[model samples]
Target: MTHPTLLHRARVLAQRFGIDITRHPSDRTGDHLVRLLDRFEIDTVLDAGAHTGGYGTLLRGSGFTGRIVSFEPLTAARAQLHRAAEEDPYWTVLPYALGDTSGTIELNVAGNAGASSSALPMLPRHRAAAPGSAYTGRQKAEVRRLDELWEEITAPGERVFLKLDVQGYEGHVLRGAGDYLDEVVGLQTETSFVPLYEGGPLFDEALGHAQRELGMSVMSMVPGFTDPDSGQMLQCDLVLFKQSDAREAALV
Candidate 1:
């Protein structure tokens, strides 16, 4: 490992170049996520809305050895996702979308390599931020509730973490978790600040649903999806943690 003094100096020098580094990269979200996994002894991760297995790769890169079940709907993306998962025996990719019900839904495939694909309609705000992410086409995809596959993906008494990057369809995904929501030790979902996707819940609504309904507490928030022109943040990833008791206490 590198020396602590050199690391500190590097962080300070990087700041002089107008780069903001938190106490630990200014509280990086992924760091907190891995910390949760280690602290809670997480064994299985449900990678919801996993585009091309990028999230699964991140988890492995971050030292998570647990099982990863990724969900991807688009054909082209799933093709890449399958190729990526070929190396990791523990990482499994499923070609489907997680929603409130199990059925077929039209998924909007974005031009930007399905990076902005979603079951919900994208609004002007989202399109303006990344023109390349504009809707390219649509395809019918099978939707399944997380609870429906809980037994197949995980075992009882195993700590499970659910990460959602389903664009604006997070609400339905959470609902589909069913009773598994209470058992989820850690949760991460992309919450939009502005109207990125039409008819989707905003930041406060999503946060409220996690805390009030799902009995989870906000552990960290990582900024994402900023407008290039205005430089305003449009969305962020909310990382939450839940304890076995009330599931209502701050992590600190």
Candidate 2:
């Protein structure tokens, strides 16, 4: 599809799903990401990999008054996030990175500011070299497991919506967030069938793990362009919801 036509379709899909995608950048408010949170019934949102706070800003603008915790690991991006949060009282910006384990780890910074970051250990293979690569490099950053972070932030019986866009670290983030899985009503993650990040699991394997271990099932795919059951391969966003919560969401 042509760029304009594709964008028009995306806008229609976003409106159908009750998301304000027109104002945000395409990379930030794709159809899959919006649909994933469409059924969430909570105010508290966790915007993991919240690059420039686009999602958080959009949620609040759409009347989500609950707390939004935005996490970004990159120094420059975190600075932007902090500035964005300053304009909104409900949004909280954190500089720590999240993964399956807690410690300091090397983050591969890519040339493209948007897709240029990952915490995977095996980096040399996935690093893209170009003019963008000039801005790309590796840096040590503090990391924590989502489960641990959830324990510190969540209250009793509070519903949480999580959006994960950490290049290829989705599986690791989910793996470390076992405690928060049951509490999470919705999840929006970028999934890759190809090895975009070194040592990252394939999309199917990651989705299976989310379904079996995290108590979430596939709710939608990004761009609204793929069949949930189609055995095709592509890199896209994967929306997930707790099985029980999904049923309730459907009933609503």
Candidate 3:
């Protein structure tokens, strides 16, 4: 279902600022997305919240030889991730989640896919309509700070690209990365202006965090089909770049 309110608002804003939102594709991870990744010359990818290894499969299919470290907390999903990596030595699957601090927590599983799961306790009004009610079962999974994982998985002098789609946990995940932000060249995060999930931040707030704390600049925002340009805000996929890396990339 398309969100007319969101589309209307986005279109109005685009008209006012002379921004071209028409060219932004609904599926951000298409050829255009791959082209953007190529521009950064990204070798290694940190696939935070990699659901069923679809993104990893896409990257490998596109000739990305660099290592992919995927993190998924759900038990069933992790099995699928393992299967996807069975033949690919470069892919390492981690059956865990990333947070500001490392410890075990309750992972609320929704019947749907990655978008439905959350680390938070309660479901938001918007997500209440999501297929399958929240599961009460709990799992003991290792939660690590991003900095620690980066040190463990990445080699020195390797430029890193992070793709964070951890439902509502993006802020906490970014916070955990701390000083390791310097090692990253590019990032793609799922943002929500409205509370699509239980604990997600608003679009402006998430963008501000990326700028002030993460030391990154917004490169682009791709709206989902439900989020049109004009009305009720939904979710967006945001691309970001470290200021220094962005400048260097521009010169290339």
By TM-score, the best candidate is 1
TM-score of structure candidate 3:
0.79
Determine which window of 10 residues in candidate 3 has minimal summed lDDT. Answer: 125-134
TM-score of each: 0.85, 0.74, 0.79
Clashing pairs in 1: 22-25, 22-26
Off by over 4 Å in 1: 1-29, 243-252
lDDT of 1 by residue, 22-121 (tens): 4643335555577777776788999988888877877787788999999998998899999989999999999889999999999998887888888889
TM-score (C-alpha, index-matched) for candidate 1: 0.85
Give per-residue CA lDDT, model 3, range 86-147, as digits (tens).
89988999977999999887777654543456786534444333323344465566788998
lDDT of model 1 at position 15: 32
lDDT against the true structure, each candidate: 0.81, 0.68, 0.73
Model 3 deviation from native, Cα RMSD in Å: 7.2
Range of the 10 consecutive residues with the lowest summed lDDT in candidate 1: 13-22
In candidate 2, what are the lDDT values of residues 124-188, reduced to their tens digit? 32332122323347877889988888867777787887888787787777778876677788787
